[model samples]
Target: MSGNDILVTDGLSKRFGDFSAVSDVSLRIQRGTIHALIGPNGAGKTTCFNMLTKFIAPSSGRITFNDRDITAMRPADVARLGLVRSFQISAVFPHLTALENVRIALQRKRGDSFDFWRSKSALEPLNLRALELLDSVGLTSFAYSKAGEISYGRKRALEFATTLAVEPEMMLLDEPMAGMGHEDIDRIAELIRHVSANRTILMVEHNLQVVANLSHRITVLTRGRVLAEGDYRTVSENDEVREAYMGAGHA
Candidate 1:
């Protein structure tokens, strides 16, 4: 792999008995870039994502992160290695205040188990950093609000905050724009851009507009295989990509 690549997959594949969900999908996600994996429904985007994050084991192939072979690593172990998945594996506690939720994630990063029995003062030291994280995601004003009570957009932002607490080298976002309105989509898109300044992000998103606006590169999948990959313009102009999306009724 090139030095610029933070994550690489070689011939990644997954199968369910006689069915192949993903086949020979190879990717090279460069450091500090926002890369999107997009395809029509049932295109194996989710299966590929699950394997990358170690949510499910890949039936074959190898995954490398920062030069380490992580194909067989467990999810938590992968996360601890600074490759974390957000959204689909959200760590936010809905009933907890946004501040508390981020604080818990911070505690986890520090290798400290949740100390619910401890007094509030014991955890107060994490408050400053937690509040900073909330501010980063534009949730400082809602820091005291219960996570479940916040607007859906803000909830996703809070998820970003919690994920940030891990100080991940890479983040795999599963449909960050899913279920979001225009305003929320814009907010999260900008937030994703801001957060990508120093870390690598690989996202699977259905919003083509978001993919075009935010991604530095895109991989198009169809029928469990890569149809094309390049910058938005290049991939968008590919004849095969156009036919694939149109045939799948995505456009």
Candidate 2:
């Protein structure tokens, strides 16, 4: 990988039986930028995310993160390198308070055996940082609220707090604005912007408006291939991208 890029993929491809879900794709994500991958439904965005996160193996490809090859690394191993993802798949404990949920995630990062409710100094120290993370995501007021009792938007923010606890150098956000009302969307957008100042972000989002607002660069996928890549203004003006969205009834 070039020093300019924190992540690079060459000819990434994935297959399910004989069906090709993603075909020969390449990407270079620069360090300290918000890069977005977008497409109409069935455009292989999820496949690429899975492959990059080490959730699934690509049929043929090479992925390098910060000058290290990661195509063969396991998911946990990749996460240890500071390439972490946060989304619904990252379970938030329902009964745990917002602060406690974040504390658990922090503890997991420490690899300490969970001695639940045990009066140990090891677990107590995490609370301070956990509360700080909650504040970072604008959830300080809900610190004592049960995770399940919090609003959906706040829960998502809590998820982000936990993800941040891991101190990721690169974060893959899964549709951060999905199902959010305008207020939540705006809040999360600002949160994303704030957190992205010193880290790299690669996200797969369907909300074009949010994508336009946050993305430093955008890649458009169609039928499992990259059809266009550039800034939002550039990709939005591309005839092929418009046509692809129109044909998929997304335009």
In model 2, what lDDT does residue 89 have?
A: 46
Misplaced by over 4 Å in model 2 are: 88-90, 108-111, 114-121, 246-251
Q: How well is each residue in 130-217 modelled by candidate 2, as lDDT tens digits? A: 9899998889999999999988888888888988888899999877888889998888888899889799999998756788989999
Top of the candidates by TM-score: 1
Per-candidate TM-score against the hidden true structure? 0.94, 0.93
Error of 1 at 95 (Å): 1.1
User: What's the residue-level lDDT of 5 in candidate 1?
Assistant: 92
lDDT of 1 by residue, 108-211 (tens): 75575766787778778899999999999989899999988988888889999998998999999999988888888889899999888799999997756678
Which 10 consecutive positions of candidate 1 have the poorest summed lDDT? 242-251
Residue 223 local lDDT, model 1: 89
